[model samples]
Target chain A: MTYCLGMLLKDGLVMISDSRTNAGLDHIAVFRKMTIWNEPGDRVIVIAAAGNLAITQEVIHFLHVGVTLPDEEEPKTIMSVTSMFEAAQLVGAAVRRSYRIDGERLEKENSGFNCSFLIGGQVGGDKARLFQVYSAGNFIESTADTCYFQIGEMKYGKPILDRALSYDTKLTQAGKLALISMDSTLRSNLSVGLPLDMAVYHRDSLELGMHRQFDEHDPYFAEISQRWSKSLKDAFLALPDPSW
Target chain B: MTYCLGMLLKDGLVMISDSRTNAGLDHIAVFRKMTIWNEPGDRVIVIAAAGNLAITQEVIHFLHVGVTLPDEEEPKTIMSVTSMFEAAQLVGAAVRRSYRIDGERLEKENSGFNCSFLIGGQVGGDKARLFQVYSAGNFIESTADTCYFQIGEMKYGKPILDRALSYDTKLTQAGKLALISMDSTLRSNLSVGLPLDMAVYHRDSLELGMHRQFDEHDPYFAEISQRWSKSLKDAFLALPDPSW
Candidate 1:
């Protein structure tokens, strides 16, 4: 399993994905799940995927090749989409291509041809945007009411994000929030492991700014992991234990 | 969907179940999911269930009417089983019976003849114990390394228990931990709603004690809910912001 989340904030968009995939407990492997399509200063589209690794990689491959959505004048790939919305459509088309290729065989085996993607970023003329594309090739964009989208092993990491994130949160604080959320996911679920991929996008910068990979040995992640665990324990201990 | 948990500890047993059940989001209803079978001074058995409400109710009824397991004695009911292990077997027998009656019809409709139960408590000459009974009527007892079992909407509420619960935790502390776990579930999941039914049994006491129901208006529950949420937010704030 994997966990991927994207948030479209006032500052821009933040995206994170875990890099572990397991067909079963014995088949666990590491595969980076984040892909960046960038033409610095023109457009920067980031996609974080979860579900079948093969399906997600195929979707990205389809996106890198040419595809056209209805009403578009040209065959546009992720790198050519004029706005974040078109970029989302391009991603959805890719997912559809994967479905066409593997859906029947996967269904016969009782293995779903399932994959979902968190696509977010900005083009030269549009504001930052984020979307969650489903296995069916349809997608939903995030708005003020729903500023974040999570796919995969989402439940273990959700309470913190539900309580902490908002569209106006500062980028640095949002980065911390995202890490703590990842930290919670890491501790509760063995299916979701590291090295985690994170991208912190600043508003209106049509370029991917900060991207990092975190493993067990990464110092900053090590500090965040140790510190967050200690903080949770300390906070829990500090709660007034009920006498009743 | 539902969420129920049972924990076996040195002080005795702790079991908690949410009241909500939903066939679908629009078809949600509330029903008590806990059943207590006690011979007072001889034994105390608690079964908390999740999955199809009808199936669970039928299993409870079967146990009440005495489902005989493949054993050396006359059909022993939960109240008469000498060891906690055998009592779990009695519950498992009921699960199998219910499945035999309805499994095929449910499968035809694409719904699982699905149900599971967490059974625990001390019986006459035995130490406290916990077991998870599957839809197939097979069961697994909780080991020292894994002292708790949860069914239904479990993930959102699991991190706290993973971090805090152990075989040696006091009954009172276990109760607090259970409540906090339930609180997290109630907050994040609409499918796992209140009022909650919780029971704490003392080891070898063969009696159920300390039972409570927490609803939206319950005073102590309201206090714990507010305080826990505050602590989480406060803890998040206390973490340093990312610099890079």
Candidate 2:
């Protein structure tokens, strides 16, 4: 299992993902789940994936090579996409292609075809966009009313995002919200472990504004995790008891 | 769908459950998921269930009557059980009997035999206890190290419990923790709904100490929910931002 989420805010986009995957407890391993495609001033697309590692890797491979659509003069890669919407289409097509090859085999083995992706970034002059692409290759774009998308092991961290995020949030604050959400998940679930990859995109910059990895000992994350826990306990203790 | 949790604490026991069940989004209804059997001064057992309503109801009926063991002189009901452990076994036996009658047929229809329970309380001289009974009726008791168990739609509400609960927590504090946990689930998932049923048992008393139902309009619950949200937002804001 994995946990990946992305926010589409007024100033830009924030994408975050944990780097733990496992077939079972004994087979746990670390695998980076976020991929960044940077083409300088033209486009900067960040994709975070969760689900079967093999399937996700195949989809990523397909995207790296390029995705061909019917009637298209040539294959379109993330770097070549004209808009964020087109980039999402390219990723969805790759997911469908991988499904076409492996879905039947997985079904026969009683292993469900489970994979999903969060695609968010800017392309040329288009505004930053966020989308959640499902296992079936279909997708839904996030709007101001729903400015974020989460995939895999999502429930544990969702209440925070539901209460804290909005489309108008500043890029820096959005990044903090994303980390706080991830911190909640890491504490509760072993399937989602650390060494997180995050990309903070500033709208119209077309450059990877800030991309960093948080390991188990990263000081800032350590501070956030410890301080958040203490603050929650303090806050919980402060609430007036039910006047029963 | 539902969310129910029980904590076995040093002072007593705390049990909380939501009152919503649904076949789908359109077919939701309010059905109390908790039941209490108190032979005051002798035994007090609170049972909270989650999963197929029909199956859980049948199991409750069986427990109401009695469950026969191969060597027992007669069927044993919760009221007649010798210990909290025995009472748990009685409930498990009832669950198995219900499964014998319906599990195969449910599987034939692809509905799947899905159900689980949390049983907690005290009997006679026995200490307060908590057990999580699985769909198969097998159960494991909570100890000083792990004193709480959650059944059904549990993840969204679990982090708070993990961070706040301990066996030494007072019964009142445990009740507050349970409500905080339930509040998070209610905000994050539509399946787990309001009008929560809660019971606070004081050890050695052997009777139901405090039992209450919190509806959507319940004043105290409303205050707790509102205050908790505000506290979380404030806590998040207090955390130092990533120095990147």
Candidate 3:
């Protein structure tokens, strides 16, 4: 299981992904799920994935080499895309390619070929964009009305995002909200562990603004986790109890 | 879909259930999911259910009338139970009876036999107890280490309960936490909605302590819903942003 989140805000984009992967209780392992393709003054593409590690890794490999999207003769790679929408299409194509190779075999084994991706970045002259690509290779772009997308173990961390995040939120503040959401998930689910990969991009900058990995010993992540828990307890206690 | 929560606390028990039931997006109605049988000075049994409304209703019906547990010669009704454990067993028996009648048919129809109940109350000399009965007619009682059980649409509302609730929590405080949890679920899920049924039981009382139905227009429920959202936003804002 994994938890990955992406936010498209006025200032930029915020993406976070947990590093824990488990085939089962005994097969847990640390695997970074975020990939960044950065070319200063040109484009910065960030992708966080969740699901079968084999499928996702294959998808990443396809994205890196190239994918022949439907209705196109030549293959396109994520770094070679000219627009954010094309970048998303390339990711989706990669997913579909992975499905073509492994979906049937995984289904036969009852694994069901589950995988999804959050791709958000700016390409050349285009504006920043965020998309959630499904296992079926279908995808949806984030809009102003719903500027955030979360994949994998999402429900436990969703309430905070629904309450606090918005399209107009500042870039750093959105990052804070994403970490808070991740903290809620980490506390409630054992499958989603520490060592988070995060990338923040400034809109139209065509370069990654901030990138960091947070482990159990990261001071800032530790502060956010502990302080958020205390704040939530305090906020809960502040609410008036029912008089009846 | 539904969301029902049961907490076994030192002061007593707090049980809450949302009233919304939907067969599909178009077929939604208000049907109370909680049933309280209060035999003053003798016993008080509150049962809250979730999943496959028809099956849950049948289970409740069986509990009301009678169920013959395996290896038992005669049928035993919930009211005839001698202890809280017996009451839980009776609820489980009722679930099994419902499954016996509708399980196969539901499976053939692709609906599946899905139903679960949270039964909590005190019988005569027994201490107050809470148990979660599964569709298989098996059940598990709550202990001090884990004193809460939630069924149906549970993940959205679980983080708060995991962080703030405990067996040592006061009954009213636990009730507040339950309501807060429900509020989170209602916001994030369309299937779980307005008009909640709540019952609080005081240990050794042998009677329902506080029983209330909160509709959309209820002032206290409205206040909690509004204030909790504001408080959460405030809490999120209070956390520090990443320095990077």
Separate clash counts for every candidate: 1, 0, 0
The DockQ assigned to candidate 2 is 0.83
Model 1 docking grade: medium
For model 2, how does the per-residue alpha-carbon lDDT over B64-117 read when each residue is reduced to its tens digit? 888975467789877788888888888788888888999899999999989999
> Residue-wise lDDT of candidate 1 within B1-244, one digit each (tens)?
8899999887778999999988778998889999887678887888899999889999898888777887554676666667878888888888887888898999999997889999988877778889999998889989778989999999988988877788988787788788889988887899999999999888778788767888889887787777777877787787776767
Number of the top candidate by lDDT?
3
Off by over 4 Å in 2: A70-73
DockQ of each: 0.66, 0.83, 0.87
lDDT of 3 by residue, A86-201 (tens): 98888888888888888899999998989999999998888889999999998999999999999999999999888988899998888888888999999889999999999999
Predicted candidate 2: what Cα RMSD to the true structure? 1.2
Best candidate according to DockQ? 3
Pairs with steric clashes in candidate 1: A11-A203
Error of 1 at A235 (Å): 2.0
Per-model lDDT: 0.85, 0.90, 0.91
True contacts kept of 2: 0.79
